[model samples]
Target: MSDRRDVWITGIGLVSSLGEGLEAHWTALSTPAKPAVDETTYAPYVLHPLAKIDFDQQIPKRGDQRQMEPWQRIGTYAAGLALDSAGLKGNKEVLATTDMVVAAGGGERDQTVDGAILTDIEKQPNPEVFLSEQLQSNLRPTLFLAQLSNLLAGNISIVHGVTGSSRTFMGEESSGTDAVRIGWSRIAAGTSEIALVGGAYNAERRDMLLLFALKSVALHSPWAPVLADPKGVPTGSAGAFLVLESPEHAMARGAKPIAKLSGVWSERAKRGEPGAIEALVDEMIRTAKGDVSEGTAILSAACGAPEPTSAEVAAISRSGLPVRSVTDRVGHSLEAQMPVALALAALAVSKGKLFAPLEGETLEEAFEGTLTRAIVTGVGHWRGEGVALVERVD
Candidate 1:
């Protein structure tokens, strides 16, 4: 392990309800303010809407912008921001070999088409036939093409020119966790000198709300801190990406590291079995605790879903580390959750402090000491569990 190259996080691009870029998010989270929530838009279901952003600033060509879906646009825009942050934008020489890993879900649904079919199918005598006909007629070939999960990587490559090896992972929060893990592992193993990794989610869709509502995991009106109200998750629109580089590579490019990525570990637990999640979480924390001395806290991506949230809380209490739930501020971003948590963890370690705790959350305690390292934890709403250690470079 000592012989492995040290991996550092040099650039971070984060866009959430708090706003875009690191400065905007840091200021908003470190201060005393309410989470940007839209309660009435979804009616009975709460969500964190994305802030208005001028697409031209990041994605210049109108033609390029028009072809991408909202999620793709968000990802491409964030990827550009990360390249710019690392001083790698338009650096054709470096970008030609930079690897990219993306975590994403399927494309947004055509709500109008879906609505029409649902409304009309019930009235038809032959409901199955009507549905089949509608599906064949209403769906466009282009719409199906847009649903490819790898398109986010393609768009980033086209717009940002990161033409290196590309990989896309699709599962939910686990995908985001694995994306970061693989990117860091590659850099540390000397297989890749630099890599871009992250994911995005658009939570302002009725289809997404309906999907969660079906599972009864969609948070309703009157948004409360996720820790205080561990009943359901309020999805938020967000995009998060990080530029990871080996120490040698970063120094060669004169890119300063914001924080050191010490380690990343991921696991899956059988939720049907009692103590399964708790056992994995405890093991991960025990392993991560070996990397720090003191002044370490946890940044948790514990979505407000009841089971996982409670399991994560028990593990945090056992670890005896002060913790803050990232979901409380940004909302549950599904595939983007782990990347968002890591970005914020790196930001916190770089600044030497943790952000303020949510107003009504009794579980989150204030940390008055310098933050030397942060352990970011992501317990998937249903299946996956992961943890990563982020520490100050110096």
Candidate 2:
């Protein structure tokens, strides 16, 4: 049971509150990053549960780091590691052959000041200056290219000397999976040889933090026995990237592949309850090779929603795979879900281990593990954007 459209993931990179670089993040996620105590009053969202690199410790050189916004910094760092993993470095072959596609729920958050725009506006002496001034004043540099959804792609192309098609798509919650789909499409279409694809979002922003706090969507306690309160869900930022290349291309380049994207499917429900994820999950398994019932471990996209969590559990119930939730360690990263989850799943495969959620966690009862298959479920609210199913074949 093989298909010619196989997309192999030769490389992966992650920048999250859990840590930076693949190894650091891999270690942090396997361990736990739970906060010491529950302190809901002190702006509960200000910090992340765990991160191996002291962000400040990895200071960016004056100019290199200064130009990037905080959120953008996380993504750029992650992209660097991903390329490194692919053994593509800042080399000419990768630059010449790769096209890029980035996905995100929301573009970069602009923190740039208007000093430059204001100065330019002030320089105009014409009466129309005021009108143009108003428009220019609105342009802020800190957030400038750094905030653009396609900024990283543009930067990557420039840095790597890539001249292929580069673009960004907004898939709300499905951005991560969609990014992979698009990359796959391009590769299949012969539009590009290698595709750099992924998504990133900084959920720790003061506004986003406050918003989640008000929504009471985050778990007060992120570890085991997460309080039943709906408000207990925690959120964090992550940048995860995967280099998708045709099997032929990767083998030609002598790339050591981690997993092959054997199949990708997507769908949207006209109207339904939160558990609509069941159908999506079912499709991924039905199309996968071999028995979907044994030794399968599910890496769920449980963003702390009981309905969707139950929905995915029901789907996996049929396939009979052990379900594991990594969000417990990495926090809820909306756009970064696919790459991060897949990366962790790949690591688990590499190490021959299954990650257990915190004790007394609700996910323990949902999966079935025998010895033949490993299925990781990634569920999210596309909020009407749609859902995608990505199969990782070893």
Candidates' C-alpha lDDT: 0.90, 0.59
Candidates in order: C-alpha RMSD to true structure: 1.8, 6.7
Give the per-residue lDDT of model 1 (tens digit) for 254-298.
Answer: 999999999999999889999889888989988998855479999
Best by TM-score: 1
Q: Estimate each model's TM-score.
A: 0.95, 0.77
For model 2 the local lDDT of residue 200 reads 70
Q: Relative to the unseen true structure, what is the Cα RMSD of model 1? A: 1.8
- Supply candidate 1's per-residue lDDT for 154: 96
Kindly provide the TM-score of model 1 when superposed on the true structure, using C-alpha atoms. 0.95
Against the true structure, whose lDDT is highest?
A: 1
Residue 341, candidate 2: Cα error in Å is: 0.9
